[model samples]
Target: MSDYCRICLEEDALDNLLIPCNCKGTQKFTHKSCLHRWQETTLNNYLCCPERYDLEQVLTCRLCKTKYNSTSANFSWRLLYTSSPLLALARKHTCVLTFGISSFMCFSFWLFFPILFNVAIFSYVVFWKKGYRFKFIGTNEGIRLRIYKIGLKVNELKSGTILKATNMIRDGMFKNSKILIVKNKEEGAVGFIFNKFIDETENIRCGGPVNQSSVHVLHDNPDVEGCEKITDGIYIGGKLIPRPENTICAIIKGYSAWDSLQLDGEVRSGLWQIDNTECACLW
Candidate 1:
């Protein structure tokens, strides 16, 4: 018997035939797109169950009730595809309104300029929050596995593994570099490098290696001059920067190599919440 998609009753094509759940024989195969459509339709009204309402609800096979493996990347891609255009439209409207009102109030420029600026900044924050935000998991050793979303905890990189480092440069060359060196007795050393000056109110552009794990070093921050590891945390220059009790640092994980420069490729990685800071690993 030939395999076919159980959902659409179509012949299984290599590209579309995906075994999302652990069902057998005729019930085994379904188109990825079809599965997503079915999930959205079925789960749209059911958000009461906390366990089934998250991303797992999206990836779980409704028929077999099993989760899909290796679907995080694709799930996230689909999510961006489905949600980004709406966000872009909202952002456009916000920009037009802010600029239009500001222009109309040119007579009272001094009085309204700051207010308009604040409003514009607030709009950007809304855009960032609703669109997508990156997550970072930091450990005593270094940073680990930058994922695209919050659900895939199994694929995160383990601690003590060294990420490849490249593109070394002086911090003075870059105006907004926040650099910190991390060292652990067991994990050796790794540097947490931020290439751009983080503007809290605006969307942040994170620059670094593509796909490959690498840390860029900046030698300019007065707090990062000494580059020493204190007892429990890192020393920025001479000041001891202690680790927070239950804080998980959020990071901007860039797009996939294939999807770079496209809205479809941009996604955030890391846990949305942190309960145990001692573990340091978000997963």
Candidate 2:
């Protein structure tokens, strides 16, 4: 690091005259590793505060704003980041920037990839629905999992919707069950048969078979202190207390629960119909 080196301006050490950017005198000569570190820091700053910092500075001189001649420093430049750190604060965000770059590159590749030039990078599965047919691409081991994740996001069910069991669900507990969906997410789903009422009080009737011990009160009371709201005027949880007139409530014990992407399969395979209008009068 001598006075000649633009980055570490010290007359204590010695290094080669690595000029990455076109700057006069003091700003020209920077060590290869030093220039790389500088580029990394610049990119980091640009990512953290995009409005304040410029991205072009990572490959150019700040003063002259000329693109850096990184013909030599381009090789294995990221390996020298641990040597000289830019700032000690917020070092955890390094992966975020790296992931952002990787994601962008992956998205670009997937977007621009033509239907003609399809390479055999990984295994795939063909999905047929309606009239359109496209291949679902994924890796070998985790392809099924990836497919499930993608399917869940696209055709996933939402909470507060009604699921009427079709004839496909033979003579099971949910055969004629018109389940009122309590909650539906990417992970799982929980609901109960609201249409079936055994009696006024809890005798033998239940919501579902999963959680039989617990009791859930589905009511139209939103003013209850600790009740979970479902849709517009419906609320779950909390006990049945004396409330306003015309506010109907169902004392349901036990509820149905489905694991990740489990209900999606049943729904798609024609086990149930996603009816928002048929089960409206029941609640």
Candidate 3:
């Protein structure tokens, strides 16, 4: 492409005047005074103060007031269970009946007792309290899970954390360019998703649900100026939604590419309470 004067829109390449104001001049140049007026109104207005938009807010759960830290990428709460020995015996009986019926159906078609026993076992187990309540928190770094089981030696355990949200996005990496943003497309809300854990020099990989199409982007790429209130999930989409403080981020770390953007019926119904506290995204 031939060099042209940006300011005058001229096609001159020699004796051109170039200034920091991004004004392009040619041999047949426009008056310098004209350039001054253009610079004051057009370019300067768009310039922003660095400090004005650099900081972001931290995130927390609205329910328990639990602030998810950057180190803890995701958080969840599960149901707890209590002891009931009477229920256990009933569950045991049901299992016996189920197996007995299967055996009889194969070898002793003539014996109906086994089938009856199996049916009884099925009912008790289905209605019994053998299942425990559980809460699960998954993050890029690890998982925090609790099982409420009566008489159990331990109530909680750290199952594991995700090394990366997706194979492409690794831990501790961020992408400032070419990020994928998802939103309602109709509502105009927007969220950001970039390749994390990028080598920067060699490879550009993003941390997310591996597949791009499954992720939802938020609308309105608003500056993460402060800790904003936790509204609907639409306000925050794709990967972990970082709080305004920059200390905590909301993430669904272990979900697969197919499951990344899906909101379960329960979550959509607003059945779950959000635990709000202060936290950030940690590697």
Best by lDDT: 2
lDDT digits (tens) for residues 1-283 of candidate 3: 3455445666644444332221223322332333444433332333343233211111222223443233322121111012234434655698887888898787765577778899988865654455433457565557877443222221111111111122232333231312223321221222233334334453233435434334332222234443233232223333335433443232322122212212121123332122222112221
Q: Model 3 segments beyond 4 Å from truth? A: 1-107, 112-127, 131-213, 218-234, 237-278
**Clashes per candidate (backbone, < 3 Å):** 4, 1, 59
lDDT of each: 0.44, 0.67, 0.33
Candidate 1 local lDDT, 43-72, one digit each (tens): 564444534544345556656777666662
Q: Between prediction 2 and prediction 3, which has the larger lDDT? A: 2
> Which one wins by TM-score: 1 or 2?
2
In what order do the candidates fall by TM-score, top score first? Answer: 2, 1, 3
User: Per-prediction TM-score, please?
Assistant: 0.24, 0.44, 0.20
**Residue 93 in candidate 2 has what lDDT?**
74
TM-score of 2: 0.44
lDDT of 2 by residue, 133-219 (tens): 233444334443322322233253777888899998889789888888888786678888876666746433568876577877777
Residue 59 displacement in candidate 1 (angstroms): 1.7
